[model samples]
Target: MRKFIQSIMLLALSAQLFAQSSDWVYATMTHESALSLQSSHPSGIVILATEGNVSAVQIQHQLAPSLKSGNLHGPGYIYRTDAQDAVQALTKNAPKKFNILDFTITEDMFVNEVLGMVSQENLGNTILELENYGSRFHTTSSGRQAALDLKEKWQEMAQAANREDITVELFQHQLTQQRSVILTIPGTEVPNEIVVIGGHLDSGDWSLQTNAPGADDNASGIATMTETLRILLAKNFHPKRTVQIMAYAAEEIGLVGSNEIATQYNNQNKNVVAMAQFDMTNYNGSSVDVGLINDAQFTSSELNLFWVELMEHYNSTGEHRITYGTTACGYGCSDHVSWTENGYLASFPFESSFGEHNPFVHSEEDTFAAMNNDASHSVKFVKLALEFVIEIAKVSTMSTQELNKTDIQIVVQNRDLIYQFNSSNKSLNSMAIYDSSARNVLSKNQLNASGRISLQGIPSGYYIAVFKDNQGKSHSKKFLLK
Candidate 1:
């Protein structure tokens, strides 16, 4: 009788998973029960997990009203997974590896050139158009149309620049009607390395058919990225590593769109150097101009530090000084969390402190006109995003090439690294071999007196040979292993 009951339970679970639809909701009595849903259903992804009572609006946006109205409240979890096979694969249940790159920005000239191109006028226009769409709720027709419009605008901008290397694509999420917009500019040298800057295009309120202009909530982020793209094209800046600008869909709906995309990238083993999220950038809610989310559990601190230093370097004139501070936005607060959950280095440069986030979000009141119709605050993020891409991706220029031109010659033969540097004892202190993903594969200290070092059993791919001389200065050269 016990064996028969077990079989019956298993059969019931299968039925629940396979029969899930858009409107279906799985309300678990306990946290353990909620996790079981992930294993059973294809789209059995968690949308909410609160210890205390949650707002009626929050429940209405993520859970079925009928179920919540029936008093199915939870200290457990709420899942909206119906048909999300791809998303399921990307979800990491435990801690994972974060791929870190070793590139540094030493070019002040290049940084200045990019910062000059940010335009408040252009950002203002982009925000105006997005707000005109009324609402961008994931399941609504208006949301779908906004995504399509964004894709076209990005494609046209790339075309006008005559950049054949840039490709604009729409990543479809089958569970929802809207698709994510991705603009990829392949690296001139290291095409495998990637840097991502993104914002959600979809916005929402309690009423799906009503207005949710979302000017500060996210249209600001999208417009900032768009203006950043325009500046990159105008300057003809081609980076050594690929840079992608993404406008995610359904971010307001539990980060649904970005989670799917990040999962796919992880499954493909793509080497993403860093990802920056710009959500709610227009409103100057806090005294500080920029808020770097210090969510240690959800963001990369190393990258956050880099943002601070970069802003400091540009703030010498005081006019562009971005008064900034750090604060946490909790887990899964924005789309950047999606990438962080997938073991990627992601950072969120939020607009204000969490407590001070625009109260107009997720409402019809979220319009540019409502924020006093100013783009100055949002422009700071636009400049930062632009610099973040160029610096992290590292544009290929004559100066960079010249810096790598040294007497040290490196060659690879028979899966071994051959190097020759004069006066290895006093001049050279240590040598290290790093893979394209910036993982240190091998290290050696105190070179031989002959000044010739040969390493064996190296894998076939592009590698960076970094040598630190007595002066404490490091120089890196890229070599291919056949």
Candidate 2:
């Protein structure tokens, strides 16, 4: 009878695991009736343990409808859970002893993405910044001067190197008193719909005195975009959407510079598809995996699908764990927030476990060697990031497209507002519009798949409409009338 009971338990366990549902009870172990109560059976490593009891029960019974929902405790546990049937069968006749032991569980784990430029050839060019960064990471005239130097070098290359394909512009923001370097790769067919990738070029020491090289802080991100540009240029991949890459100024001063551009796009209602922040992508050895710190406002099913699929991809391809960090809509610790808060699928990726903790950061020693490590871990981080970009920047259905206020008049009879877009590409799937003043007016409903949106019943005012293409790209336009 005892042997029969054990067999029945095994069968029940198998059924529960196959379903992988949290709607029923699932127990790890119980003193009263675990088949192995008498002797130990091989099980997953005990990352979570009980203090005094030889055995403990992890009963996962449903509570009130409002208590909570999903996976035993969500994706935060290490071991696989037992099938619900197994829990039910064992608990059916178990005494009170089975329900009383103290227990614990492990916290969620995830993989990290290395975001900076670290390719071998680019690595050769980037390492020069480590040796030549003038030994300081301040927003000094020296720093701005360094930025100027980059512009000059690239300008010379764009002309003499016969590389006019890459146009680099320096924008000195009048409002924020900061500098912005915008790089554009105009689309061959769809030149208006835009796809933008950005990183803050500013680096800083927390003390604001010492010269922190900020190699990993952002040089990594800058390098990645630059190298990514080089790769795309070499491949001659003509995206249906125009691509814009930016190196923002004053990021260390609390993302002020990026905020200027983000807010600019926000105000104009520029068509923006997906904006990504590639900060601190190199030199982390911690086991913690990549972080997808996304704001909650987007709640777009498409955005949610991207994150879920991205993490699932990492779990299958690598050994690290990946997870979502926060739940609130207005919470994020990186430059992506500027885009996220304005209704874009903005996000930042981090590799280190304690996100805001960098011991050598903001110091002269925050050089390439500090985070540009070549450990096995580093290799995975680099590969994961590179692959992620390759996948993300490959939107193909329609290039970003933006229409002028005149175009808006032709489409809608409201005749009450003016529309303007940074660029409206000739393609279909992606686009964005910035309403420098009326950004919050667009989320009328779930416009996730609304190809041709209507703005009826809306108060007459200037507005920007940003259309993000379905195929991983975006475009924007401004509107005005009456």
The best candidate by lDDT is 1
Error of 2 at 172 (Å): 1.2
Give every collision pair in model 1: 43-81, 44-81
lDDT (0 to 1) per candidate:
0.69, 0.45
Residue 43 lDDT (model 1)? 55
Each candidate structure's TM-score, on Cα atoms with residue i matched to residue i, is 0.70, 0.50
In candidate 1, residue 431 scores what lDDT?
A: 83
Q: Candidate 1: what lDDT?
A: 0.69
Reference-based TM-score, model 2: 0.50
Give the clash count for each candidate.
2, 78
